[model samples]
Target: MAKFALLIGVSEYQPGLNALPGAVQDIKAMQRVLQHSEMGDFADADMTVLENPPRHVMERAIENLFSNRQKDDLVLFYFSGHGIKDDSGKLYLSTSETSKYQSGELIQTTATAASLIHGMMERSRSRRQVIILDCCFSGAFAEGMKAKDDNTVDIKNQLGGEGRAVLTSSTATQYSFEQEGEDLSVYTRYIVEGIEKGAADTDNDGMISVDELHEYARKKVQEAAPAMKPEIYAVREGFKIKIAKAPVGDPQLEYRKEVEQCVRNGKVSVIGRRILKRRQSELGLSVEVAAQIENEVLEPYRQYQANLREYEEALAEALQHEGTLSQHTREELKRFQQLLQLRDEDIDLIEVPVAIEKDTIKQSEFLYQKSTETLIYKLRHQLVDITSTEIELAEQKEYKDEGLFERFTERAIEAIRLAQEETLRFGHNFIGTEQILLGLIREETGVAAQVLQLKGIKLADTRIEVEKIIGLGSGFVPPELPFTPNAKRVIELSLEEAKTLKHNYVSTGDLLLGCIRLEEGVAVRVLENLGVNLQNLREQVVHTINLSKNKNIQSQ
Candidate 1:
């Protein structure tokens, strides 16, 4: 029986429609498989391809594809383009001339109606007919068919006949997606892959049936784009129609299937690696060959993750400049999405959470501001009153004088407050040792600041070094930020330093010693980066304390 095929791809469209450059590449890919000797085995002379055809040209080619065919002949028609629906939900296959008005109304005359294609299929003499559509709303071709409760069209009841099969890229209500940076559309890419790689041949049969081809493409399309649901419909005997040949018992194909089973979240588990190694030995495949196959299977997943990271980085950078995204920033981010070849759905998954966090931060800041204003007003008007519990606690603390916090002098307390301010200044949500170091340098009246200045370590230089070590934070900053474990350890160590000096109260000098003692803290890293000698700095602080003590004794 003669095999005839006509493939139509419309990459160019009128002003209103977005151009699909992948559509034309899709037709080329399909033609390669159909005319391949070991695949569809269709004669080159009988194969026809039309690229960016106008409405009339596309209509005529489709009509001629189904006309004057023998009953036993195999006839296939494929289209890759925009499939739009009117206000009444009538599906139309868009041609190069297809466009919409300013009101977003579909210009019916510019597109080819699906009804026309269905009519041509009904009048065809060939029983072995195949119709494949890769476009939005392609499943609408099964219109008037009995639909499932979920709105899925029953193609077998409506358009299926003996030896006839229909395949679509998406459901009746879904939009077929085209990935950016890809040469072919997502659905059509898998279709060609199934045929070229002979992966469509299930059950180890030497030939690939139309049913097998549809199932393979459907599974793969969902893997790359979960929202897309490819579909197939066929009547009795149509499911068994052979569309291509396969290399039976191919070891590479078997290995690929094994690799697919072992992969999760784009990685092979430790146990999965062992399983793959055993399979590789059994198949007599070299290690290099096995690794190459595994990489190929993991490529798409890796690309997806890489795209996510890129988008998140860009968003974080934008957030560093402002709490909320500005209109210009939003527009720039949209353009970045296209440049990254990411879909709107994919980016939404990343952006929505960050946006919510920003909103939360704004509310928290508002509350914090109001509370601060109230505190200032009370202090200014002398309206502040100490509660009985607070007074009792203070009396107990002064009597004991054992609590390390109570031992902190007013200057030391100011240093700690300065540390928290430093944390917020850097847009960080948590106070770390780096901020404590900066606080000691900023409290110029304290012994710690005096010693640092003597050693030529200025606050500005320390701030720069700290920034170099820990870049600006991109997340939300709450009203009360907690200190990191290392920062807390520094505070505890400061109390110990005060006791070592036989002092009744903790001083800013003690805080500096605490930071120096915690060698693993980021504060130490910043100090080292600033070319400070920790041992010398410690000695100078001790000597300065001694000089102050001697001066006090002389005055007495």
Candidate 2:
């Protein structure tokens, strides 16, 4: 008892772009196979042949697919045309008449490739869903494109139940091609042709699953163009394609269940709040508590401003007594002035007026200083003793040669950058500890050397150590893998662990404790040799963070 198919072909639009030629061919072939390709009860699909559909109509098509699928059924969604995103990565499906850049804010936003897959996978039924995106910029469209309807790109995590998969024409940045003589897209041509010939079942399992068809289409297209790479990403449980040709039957109840699960209603603001709620457990504070702490810091910051004004006044008075401030004081003042001069980047720090009154009342004193320019930089109200630029510059500067620890970090910065790049590519703003761990493992020198030496541990040797621990026949792949956590936490935990044993900065001891916290790496044995209890070390880090306000050396 195979289920029904939902095939939607989008080629024509009002927004200057014409409907694609191959779209009709693709739609026809898919329609033919879906009705009678295999073990279905021969049900005809309710087809939607849209040409330049309105925004709401396209969104409805996505909503319809997931909302109408069943456990044993296969739901197929196909798209063809031009797609693009703005600077913020919000995707837009052009109407034959729309502008790529200035799409109206009120326009109905379409589902991105990532959102399409993730949403459909949320279904509770055993039904498998397959989506083929045929358009320029269609590859990573679902994953990276923001949820325009929601006003944010941050999608929440919701694992799908069974049978779901996605097959797309190209990666997000690559442009898909259309056949020259025909109206259909080159991508659609191969897919439709493959279905007609029945080469989609690669494993010869008698029936074609979404995964099978996707892999076949991707391979088949390589001959058309050597440079074009098509990709298929399979998610959720297994599924099969049961295509049959008959008049439509009653829509399956299981698809209805899957569709019910895929409804992701609301905006990005709501999604962010949900993420914070889940993360609060690890912080040991409610969202309100974190906000409270932030508010508490403000009053003291204002007080610092008052102190800074007083210091500046006193310094001016002292300068008058001597006829000018000392060279060091002058240099410091000049530093603040320079900061004020180049601050267009952070406009919030434009408070302090450089023309403060002089302590000495000489006639020449007021007229001596000449023209000036204004600049902006973000400054802390509590840091009244220095300009905003100085505060930030101080924060950004690494302490060097302050014992061996400073020297160790000076050399490790580049290695850290490489790891940070990798994390950034995955779309995170900050490099977390897992990246730091990976960085250390990659370099194994300088700061990494210090990290390893604290507990007399070595990463290369530690892999052997891990083999030793699990060698006793507890064959579970160690969960909580290392070098995967956030970099800041890794540094914090590593530093704190080292400090317990009285090490000056991060050392091998820190590295071992890090691996131990991961609870599965061979690096854990080093902690055992150091006579450090894993429970005690973990508790110590908790205590340090709870008691201290800021552990991040590079504080925001």
Candidate 3:
């Protein structure tokens, strides 16, 4: 089962484009990874790397790579280049000469890297196609082309059968960064090293599988930079990968110094790194141990470091408070001495200031009753500020469930239950969210969701036109509806509406009104969970509802 790779990385553009040291670095590093990593051995077949290639050359490179592939064969296509989108978010592959970055029109009328990939996939007889695109705006490259018009068709959905798998360097709107000591893009560096580390190398042989490479690339990228996520969208299960298992150690923080020393001293390495790669095969170590040793390249004691920082911070805060209190005491003691001097002639017992020895001691026993009054006043002001924030948070948390509107919790709980079902029925441990959404979508008839569903609003329609509404890493909130004090208030507002002239048990359409009324409630929160803006869902729902009403009237 030999696998072939079509690797394309472009760094130098025909001047005036964003300088992409990333593309060249990505290709060279991946090549070494493919050679030394287990995937390179397992898929140890023909691989081509087109460095700084022109557009036409890149396309040719792909076509040539697939020239020998078969339906059962695995094909991996890697691209590292600059990408941009049109106004419609249609992604375009930068030819060594794509001038002027167009914001809105970027995606509408552009030729994309994904389109190129789709062409390769359609032409190839390969059963599983794994594509890794490590470039700025890489997610845009896959937006229009990877999935087959159906959101469920592409690599991310893991629905591949005869199609390819797609892995992107960054989601839409963001750029990938560099790793320390690695010339490759941070993402590419880890991906290649991950493969070399045998995290992707499944067979214990020195070869990494295509799937393993993808997972390794994704997990490593995510850990290194949580903000810029590397995604793996698979259309099919191509390879049985042996993920680089972490070495077994003390579950608690019992042997951390020993662990750090071992890592620093070369007894360990993280799962995906190039530094100690040469020693991996020679170690004859378990995959877990090997992976852990490789991960050490990053030094995974941040939690302990965080704890240490927190301790230092607490000490500083305590000292600051101590300084402020001491200053207050010094002033109070001075006032007490002045009062005692005033009372010296009368020698009054009640007004006598308590005499103390040293500067520290004199301040320590200064008048407490007056200080208590000032402390109480400060405490009240602090309490007021804290109280307001807690009240606001309480309001927000009340709708955390969106009053059953967003049942992320319920869905999560149900997901666990269904996971049990899956294990009981099929005996697999990986119960994914996609499956949960699929199952829930089929079973749901809630009043709020029904408005969209009734008019043929497919949840999967995001495939065709969602990225335009929500750019990468964006969030949205819906518009306002009438304030409803209670559930009955929602019903009352619906009844007051012109459309629901005659109603009985409240059709799902009426629930739309209810959702809109409670727009400030769970409805908006649920939309946020799906990454759907309230405005987008509102317009879509209105359009669908109107369309349905028109059809019904026509029939009548």
| Per-model tally of clashing residue pairs | 0, 54, 36
Please tell me which model should have the higher lDDT, number 2 or number 3.
3
| Displacement of the residue 409 alpha carbon in candidate 2, Å | 55
Q: Estimate each model's TM-score.
A: 0.58, 0.37, 0.44
- Which 10-residue window of candidate 2 scores lowest in summed lDDT? 347-356
The TM-score of predicted model 3 comes to: 0.44
lDDT leaderboard ranking: 1, 3, 2
Compared with the true structure, what per-residue lDDT tens digits does model 1 show for residues 1-556? 8999999998888896667788899999999999999888989999999999999998999888899999988899898888776776556788989988899778999998777888898999988888888875532212111111112333444456677898888776554766556798878988998888787787777898989999989877766665567888888878887888888777888888788789887899899999999999999999999999898777767766776778878887788777667999888887666545466656655553343333334443443344434533432233112112322454677733235544565456667678877887898888899998998888765567767765678989998988898998876776556678898789778878878877656767788899999999999999899898999778766655554433331100
Candidate 2 vs candidate 3: the TM-score winner is 3
Q: What is the C-alpha RMSD of each candidate to the true structure, in Å?
A: 18.6, 26.0, 24.5
Per-residue lDDT tens digits for candidate 2, residues 149-253, read: 112222122222345555667555454655435545556766754455454544444455566666656654543332245665554464354332222221222
lDDT of 2: 0.42
Quote the positional error of residue 391 for candidate 2 in Å.
Answer: 71
Score residue 482 of candidate 2 by CA lDDT. Answer: 24
Give Cα distance to truth, residue 133, candidate 2, Å: 1.2
Off by over 4 Å in 2: 16-19, 37-42, 45-48, 92-126, 138-162, 236-556
